[model samples]
Target: MSLARTFVGFSSTDINYYRLMTAWKANTNIDFDFVDCQLQNSINSENEVYIKKLCRERIGMASKFIQLIGQDTRHKYKYVRWEAEVAIEKGCTIIGVNLNAARKMEQDTCPPILRDIGAIFIPFSPYIIKYAIENYSMGPEDWYYYGNEIYKGLGYE
Candidate 1:
């Protein structure tokens, strides 16, 4: 089977984790072709219009969006937030992965928009990641909202 097209949204400080994920993908059976949306080159002189256009286009092509939450992630909103907003608008399945070392004690520390939209937050586990990617439904109504909490329709606990 072909791998799912995934877009990874993260802070620049977490670049090493992204690199590790890439290496893991290369060495393991993770079934997703990851696209690193974090800008590496200097965009100092580039036009904002062009940058946004390029990012939106790349995110548009992805079927799944993974936001790696780190300590600095909640404070860095420029690229990560923009990428996630575009992904949500494009109907990509959003999965928030809490870095093992940076896991926050409060759920409210999660990106506000992601939490408001009821995105599933999971620990950094390869099996859970694969399961989330494979089982996430694309329809809007597939998400479950109960009382004050949003539960993933796939019965994640």
Candidate 2:
């Protein structure tokens, strides 16, 4: 199956990071959209209800969530944790990509929840992504339909 929908979360500061996902889409010819949860001004003014509503307003909903687990994420943003939890609660498949060593030779790091959630670990590299996408047989159609059902149940409409 072809890889279709995916939820991408990263520090809004991480611009280059967004490009990596785009590159994957280009190479694989897959329809992948990145969900930007970057709190630009402040979440203080952002009401809880709106935040929850915006949380579910994805530009393109994907069946899989490629969470970029980094040290900065846990510190810089709390919403990352919330979004991941929401996705998991909704039963979306989460794929943990270790980009530490993928970019740097340094030891790779990942969020603790990844281990607890039993997320599949993939080396942060284009080669590994290609392999995983090919080996996994999930298309965007299945992802979109299933994700839509889950979101609608949660009042995404």
Best by lDDT: 1
Local distance difference test values of all predictions, in order: 0.67, 0.51
For 1-157, candidate 2 gives per-residue lDDT tens digits of 4454566665555547657766665654654333333333344545767765666655125556666755565554466666777667766666655556332111335554444454555545554444443344333321111233433443334
Once superposed on the true structure, which residue ranges of model 1 sit more than 4 Å away at CA?
28-46, 101-108, 138-157
Candidate 2 lDDT (Cα, 0 to 1): 0.51
Model 1, 1-157: lDDT tens digits are: 5567788888889877777777766765664344454444546655878878878877888888988888777777777788889999998888888886322223544677676464666666555566656666543432221221223433345
In candidate 1, the residue pairs with backbone N, CA or C atoms under 3 Å apart (3 or more residues apart, or in different chains) clash, namely: none
Worst 10 residues of 2 by lDDT: 138-147
